[model samples]
Target: MSDVSARDAARDKARDRDGAMSMAGMSSERIESDENVWTRRLVTFLRVMAVISIMKGLYHWAQVTGFIGSEEEAFENQSMAWQTATVYFAVIELVAAVGLWLATPWGAVVWLTTVVSMAVIELMFPGIYGGSLTVVALEAVMLGAYLALAWMAARERPP
Candidate 1:
């Protein structure tokens, strides 16, 4: 072959070899790490919490719209405190749910705030939600789980 053709063939072979090496490097880099596993678990937990938040928000909205109560217990007929709480929760819970679903930092903050607020209300102002200890306990457990998962995921990250 001519010198020019020989040079071109050598360059093509080099490029092919480099391409194969890069592909192999990419596959090796894809090996699952502890951080990746923990992050995925955290994401899944957040998604589940988001669904629960959505349901809670919808429930509050139903209450406010008189869709889940008797005529006498309608939103207009409820005490001012109940009306205010229902509306506040109806809006905030849904917002928090969206944030959580997105798996963003702000979403976790918002969700935590919502959980703590509900727990406090249930404990300190029993009249609002009729003081369900069960609800408070559940919220505490969920909060603990979230914190644990977040801690694990963060710890697994490379410094």
Candidate 2:
């Protein structure tokens, strides 16, 4: 082979080798730490949270509209308008989570905003049961989940 041909072949081989490890839907970034790997998995979980957040908002809206009742009595503590607002906010939160998982730049913004909302609400609201037995659980969990998604996504260098 000519020098140019040999050089081209070498570059192609290197690229192929780099690509091989990523085979079939795998990512090129190899996570070095176990915690970081789990953090990435949390991003996938956050993607699922996209659907859950929307559903949760709908459920609240349903309650306010009289289509459903709160599974927990604590919801009775909140007013109908408050419930409605919660529904609207939750839906927005869900949409943002989805956007983030999709790697839209706005996703990080949504995640940060919602997680702050979550932290604040969790501090304010006491559920039907004491000591963490409430929808506060969701606020708590999703707060971390959104943060994790944002963090991991930041680490991700898109292919």
Candidate 3:
């Protein structure tokens, strides 16, 4: 073979070898890290958070729709603003949950924003949204877990 043809053949072989271990059905920027424990843990954490987010969304939706309890029970005689906020939270949270489940960058960002926003709303509105110390504590814990997993995944280069 000519020199140029031989070099092209060698390069193709190298690419094929590298591609063998690459993940399929994911973005090109994603990298498989099966050997990395941190990646595995991070994925698990994200999935767990996704489930929680979905459940939270559903709960809020039930409240807003008056399926779970009376309107008074859900809103606790809160103003229209608080009631509207509840509906908004339900929709945004459900969307964010799906994004997080897909392991997309936007999902993480949305989930983080949703959690923080909920915490703030609860704190500011207090009894209007059935805010409680327990809810705040749980949010803090989940937020910490998400941040730690994100940092680990970034460091490990998860697939």
Best candidate (score: lDDT): 1
lDDT of each: 0.91, 0.63, 0.81
Q: 1-159, model 2: which lDDT tens digit per residue?
A: 599999999999999987885573496665575545655676567577666656655765665566666556345666664565566575676677577668565775776576566555555653312225365566667677666666675576444
**Highest TM-score against the true fold, candidate:** 1
When summed lDDT is taken over every stretch of 10 residues in candidate 1, the lowest stretch is 28-37
Candidate 3 per-residue lDDT, tens place, 1-159, comes to 699999999999989877875545444776655667777787788888889889989988888777887656766565787788888889988998898888888998898888888788788877566778788788999999878877876787635
lDDT of 2: 0.63
Tens-digit lDDT track for model 1 on 39-135?
8999999999999999999999999888898999889988887788889889989999999999999999999999999898899998977889999
List the RMSD of every prediction in angstroms: 4.6, 7.8, 7.5
Model 3 TM-score on a 0 to 1 scale: 0.70
TM-score of each candidate structure, all chains considered together: 0.81, 0.49, 0.70
User: What local lDDT score does residue 70 receive in model 2, on the 0 to 100 scale?
Assistant: 53
Better of 1 and 2 by TM-score: 1
C-alpha positional error of residue 8 in candidate 2 after TM-score superposition, expressed in Å:
17
How far in Å is the alpha carbon of 6 misplaced in model 3? 27
Q: What's each prediction's clash count?
A: 0, 0, 1
